[model samples]
Target: MLRSCLSKVISPCQSAFIPGHCITDNILIAYEINHSLKLKSCGQERSMSVKLDMSKAFDKEAERCGSISGFRIGSRGPTLSHLFFADDTLLFGKASLQEAQHIRTILDLYKAASGQEVNFDKSAVVFSKNTDPTVRRSITQLLNIMEVPTHDKYLGLPTVVGRSTSEVFSSVKERIWQKIHGWNEQRLSKAGKEIMIKAIVQAIPTYSMSCFKYPDSLLSDIQSMISNFWWGDGAKRKPIHWVSWDRMCLSTNDGGTGFRQLKAFNLALLAKQAWHIATQPSTFLHRVFKAKYFPTKDFFQDESTSRPSFTWRGLCAVRRYLLSGSKWRVGNGLHIKIWKDRWIPRPSIFKIVSPSDALPEDSTVDCLIDKDSGK
Candidate 1:
């Protein structure tokens, strides 16, 4: 009987007037009947329906928060509302009562639906250095959130501003050291050690390497640890060095073990980020970077400022590698600047001429083409 009813509701698209509507109607009817029957079986005279729906409410609130202007990255750019990954959420907005109230309302709606409460004691609100302490306190009180000086960790990596020095990555080194120490090196063979180093040790700092330029000293410390393990060195004693560390880092085809060099690997990873920024300009991260750093110019020509953020500096540092290999393929010639861009085939002289020798200050390749003639 159930199958027959279901079949009537769940027919071919052409057979039913509105295919899923019948199924939905049948399910609602079945639910109502089941609930009434249960109530009657319990000898209940009346029953009440309790609906717990907050997804729409939360979505509406998120939309409203996004609609309102928040913290701007530059003089003219898109505002940021929030960035979320799983349950880890970071809200960004101007320090004001209205923003605080909106956040509170969203949290309240979330709590009511999920039966999960927000622990304001643990949660904190952070403000920029330029923000006034009085205003910070006011916003903190309005949202009932604790005001914190700085965030130590976000998504496992440490949150930092300027260049990530050796001290900043000390904890990462210690964690890798601990992992290496915990292993039974005595029982593990040379091959086993190599495998462990490749699989585990190399992956430890990958996320950090992709974001920041690891200090040479930090890289050296990590490499030393990996080398000691590879050559069967104990906690105290030094082992005999058969092969140079450089040889082991080379490809296996070149009489080496194929271990990666940390510095080169870090550069390659960062270069990948630069590649994305160039090719995938439509991505959210690329858009944010373009707006803030290179708003009116090409990314390659972006001059380093005295106060560039650590992340921006790292990206800029690796951008030269990308620019050295890249050449512009002329289409309409509208986007490529004459002297600033590398549109020519010459390896040494990629630009048509030096900035000093170029005809006009702001001429593009389009100037060379004749508009009226086929040539």
Candidate 2:
């Protein structure tokens, strides 16, 4: 009854809180970053993110908290103030005492109205590196929340992306090693190891893979670790590698264990994310990225070699795979060219081959169709 009532009463504008909503926790976290830090010096304007572990959510009064003034990503992007999650809320603002006080005031008002206390001890704040030490000290003192290190995470992902991406995600490797070490104790059969590798090991880096493209060296290192495990005995002694790892990655009908190759699988995961950004214009991620990266053009048409983030790089890197897997829908086919575009379902090239002279190279797909038949 409650769900049914919510379906009608809840504004269609909200993508959450009603029955059969597709806005998931993971999807929300994908937009958790406001993403505007360039490693400034002490005198520059500093930005900070405050993570609040709250026992509860808020009423419309919290929504009406007005602007404490959150930073914007691109010139055209929306200003993000705060994001509320199931267990925590992220508040973004400048590293000024005034901003900190405003945040505090908002929290106090919530505590007064909701009667649910915020876990201040569990909450913490992180600031950009270039922020003045004095400013950082003053804000934390004002808010009464501990200041976290620069590399602190918001929603299990790093808030600050430094120069070294490999170092940033080295934890993925560490996690895999720990899991493998624990599993090695079982002395499982070859069949069991294959299943574990497919299910658990591959899943470990998927979330990270969706955002950042791992360096080739790091991918090689991870592959080496998995390869070592597959070939090694339960003990320290290395067993002989009978077949190559590539061959083992083939399908059962192809005469090998059907393990997914990590690099390709990682690319596929990122491509899926890119696909969402391209197709789902209503998504917050699509709006944010489109504003920052491809303001004048579409996602596929963007080849901006400018100072791109790792997230943008990952999305753009999988363009080839995405293009290869996709083709024109051909509604009127006013836009698609016969020879230039990928419309045909054939292999090697999706474009029509044979004689380019039969139909002019500039001809659109609409030409060959019978006018009345619509074939």
Compared with the true structure, all predictions reach lDDT values of 0.61, 0.72
Q: Write the per-residue lDDT of candidate 1 for residues 1-375, one digit (tens) a residue.
A: 564575354322111243222222222122222222222323212211111112222233564537333444455545545443333444555556666676677777788777876666656665555555677777778777676655444545545533448887898899889988876456587787888889999999987777677888999999998887777645567766788889999998999999999999999988976676667564445555666678876677765454455566777889888988888988778888887788887788688664765467768788887887723
Local accuracy of candidate 2 as per-residue lDDT tens digits, 152-222: 66557765566787898899999999988888888888998989999999889988776667888888888
Which portions of model 1 miss their true places by more than 4 Å?
1-60, 65-68, 162-164, 233-235, 304-306, 346-358, 372-375
The candidate that wins on lDDT is 2
Q: Give me the candidate number with maximum TM-score.
A: 2
Q: TM-scores for all candidates?
A: 0.77, 0.78
Those runs of model 2 whose alpha carbons end farther than 4 Å from true positions after fitting are 1-34, 39-46, 58-65, 128-134, 148-151, 303-305, 330-375
- After superposition on all CA atoms, how large is the RMSD of candidate 1? 15.9
